[model samples]
Target: MALMITDECINCDVCEPECPNDAISMGAEIYVIDPGKCTECVGHFDEPQCIQVCPVECIPKNPEHLESPEQLMQKYHALVTAKNDA
Candidate 1:
């Protein structure tokens, strides 16, 4: 599943650099997670790095963008391919 940064985010700036998929970015207020680019670090780590580093514990699985492990892996591959091609 993709992870989301909740409103409770303190803009601590820790989670953005931790995202292997580059899904986290500065929103108008707090940081935001792009569900399309988030793979929950499936290919890069056993757990989501952003969640591990976020001090506020505001990151959580996005119910609106759920995916199985296999699907997340596929998305990770797709992201890798697209990045390589670019």
Candidate 2:
């Protein structure tokens, strides 16, 4: 599943640099995760790097965008293939 930043985000920006897929970006006033690009770090790390660096624990599982690990891996593979094709 992809992670999401809640309203509690302090815009600390710590999580932005930690995202392995460059999936996190700053919104007008908070950080947001791109669900299309998010693989929960399956392609890059054991855990979500953004979650690890978030100071306020604002990042959490996106209930509205849940996916199994296999699905996440599939998405990760697709991203790799797309990049390679590019």
Candidate 3:
């Protein structure tokens, strides 16, 4: 599943850089996670890098954007391809 930044995010700016896919960003109120770009670090790590580094533990699985591991891997491949193309 894609991950999400909850309201508990402290905006410490730690999670943004940890995301391999550049899926995390500062929003109007707090840090936000882009489900479209979020592969939960499937292509880059055995675990989600943002979740590991978030001091506030605000990052959680996005129930709204639920996805299986296979789906996430597919998204990761797509992201890599797109990035390489650019």
Candidate 4:
């Protein structure tokens, strides 16, 4: 599942660069995760780099966009498969 930034975030700008999918962005008051782009590091890393680097520990699973590991795998494949075919 894509990670969601909680309001507890201090906007410290730590997690933004850690995401391989470039899913994290600086919002007005907190960091935001783009669910459509977030593969939860399924195809990139063994773990979610953003969660690892976030000191605030405010990144949590996006309940609204909950997805399983296999779903994440499909998402990763769908994203790169098309580009590779190009």
**Candidate 4 per-residue lDDT over residues 1-86, each given as its tens digit:** 88899999988888998987778898877889999989999999999998999888998899899899999999989878866797
| Worst 10 contiguous positions by lDDT, candidate 2 | 13-22
Q: Against the true structure, what is each candidate's TM-score?
A: 0.97, 0.93, 0.97, 0.89
Candidate 3 lDDT over 11-72, as tens digits, reads 99888998899999999999999999999999799999998999989998999998999999
**lDDT value, candidate 4, whole model:** 0.89
Please provide, for model 2 over 3-83, each residue's C-alpha lDDT reduced to its tens digit, 9 standing for 90 to 100.
888999998878888877788998888889999899999979988888888789988899999899999999999999988
| Candidate 3 backbone collisions, by pair | none
**Residue 63 deviation, candidate 1, in Å?**
0.5
The CA lDDT of each predicted structure is 0.93, 0.89, 0.93, 0.89
lDDT of 1 by residue, 1-86 (tens): 78898999999999899898899999999999999999999999998999899888999899999799999999999999999999
- Order the numbered candidates by TM-score, best leading: 1, 3, 2, 4
Off by over 4 Å in 2: none
How high is the lDDT of residue 79 in model 4?
A: 74
Note each model's CA RMSD in angstroms: 0.5, 0.9, 0.6, 1.6
The total of clashing pairs for model 4 equals 0
Instruction: State in Å the error of residue 39, model 2.
Output: 0.8
Colliding residue pairs in candidate 2 = none
